[model samples]
Target: MKKWQLQDIRIRDPFFLKENGEYYLYGTTDVNTWEGNGEGFDCYRSKDLKLFQGPYPVFRAPQNFWADRNFWAPEVWKYRGRYYMIASFKAEGRCRGVQVLISDDPRGPFVPVTDGPVTPTDWECLDGTLCFEDDGVYMVFCHEWIQTGDGCICAAKMSGDLTKLTGEPEVLFHASEAEWPVIHREFDSEGFVTDGPFLFRDENSRLHMIWSSYGEKGYAVGISHAQKGVIGKWNHERNTVLEKEGGHGMIFEGPEGRTLLVVHTPNTWLKERVKLYSVEKLILGG
Candidate 1:
């Protein structure tokens, strides 16, 4: 059997799930994520979160799928006694968008639940995550600044069956709206690239979101809180949560009932590695 090490896996947009006494890690596993056409998403399973097993082929691209490359950020969750995945994909000319996938198991050959991407057909977006609030399901995703030069995170309500969008997506915030998010490339012309947006509510009922962006220092994680418990009314925090060239983080519980944060560190294609951090109890000030 092949041994598992953090360096061995070339992944982006790392996500974690604790189920049945085990930790399952999922992400974009294309060997050539930065260039060239790529393969489908894969996952790894571990107990201690240090050693992983299998580059398990959970979801494989169909023969003539519309989005043949740039398959990224596959986040799975258990809902209604079934497994659902919100993942990003790209095609020949269309911009990246999130689509839903369904599976009977966590380690799945997740099949598409949507006819096509869920984000607006005219908008460029990526890194979609499912958020349940006020008895409704919402798909929160990032509108690629690559196209607009001002990336923004937005959310749209999903239909009951999770097969389609229920309403128009609402603009939550822009990459430039956050005090910590900055533009990295001065040459490319696009102001900033806002990547992943993961949502979670803390024990005190404070809704927080962690998203990725390149700042004055480097690529880092910026956090924001929802002042009124509404998804779109988030106010930016002055300080970033994790600022050491790491991002695309999501919070999950460990087997020991501890909250943990999973994100890819060194945020560059050549130096990225999956890292886990213990979530400390902290209070959010309004």
Candidate 2:
């Protein structure tokens, strides 16, 4: 068996799924993740976080695929007994957008399910993840700062089958909205960046979101508590969750019910690697 170490893998926007005693990992898997043509998403299976097995190919692009490059942030969710993927793609002249794919198995050859990108065709969007809210399912994604000059985390209601968006997206907050000291000049003409929005519910059903932004140090993670509900106002923690090179993050339960935050480090173009840190304290209470 070929064993793998977290530092040795070049994956971004890492997402972990805990099944019946097995951990399934998914993320951006293109050989050249930063640019050029994209192949598709892949999966890694493991009983423990360390020594992952297999770069199991999950979804490969079909012929005449709309987007050929910039495949990023592939997040998988088990919905209605079907595995669905929400990832970003970009073509030559078209703006980056999030699209949906479906498969019968978690580690599968997923095929495009949606007619096209669920996000606005002209809007620059990415890092879309599935959000199951009080009323319905929603897509939480980032509107790139490059396009709006002030990146934002937005949420939109999804159809029951998760095929399309049923409502207009509402901005939950901006990159500079967090209550932390930012070292980088993100609020200036350079623009603030908002990436990776994942929702986690505490014991009390209180909702908290983990997202990425550049801070006083560098690529950082921020946690926000939803004041109302899933789509409601969110209050940011005063300090960054991880004020290091690791930014884009998602939480998953590891062995012995240990909460782990999986994120990519260095924030580089293609040299990024996923790292995990214990986050049990964050999920103790609701």
- RMSD (Å) per prediction: 2.1, 2.4
Model-by-model lDDT, in order?
Answer: 0.81, 0.84
Off by over 4 Å in 1: 6-8, 281-286
Q: State residue 89's C-alpha deviation in candidate 1, in Å.
A: 0.7
Candidate 1, residues 20-78: lDDT per residue as tens digits? Answer: 87778899888777557757888888888778888889898877676878888999988
Q: Tell me how many clashing residue pairs each candidate has.
A: 0, 5
Tell me each candidate's TM-score: 0.93, 0.93
Expressed as tens digits, the lDDT of each residue in 36-89 for candidate 2 is 789888889888778788789898889988999989989888899888988999
CA shift at 249, candidate 1, in angstroms?
A: 0.8
* lDDT value for model 1: 0.81
Regions more than 4 Å wrong, model 2: 181-189, 281-286
How far is 88's C-alpha from truth in model 1 (Å)? 0.8
Top lDDT: which candidate number?
2
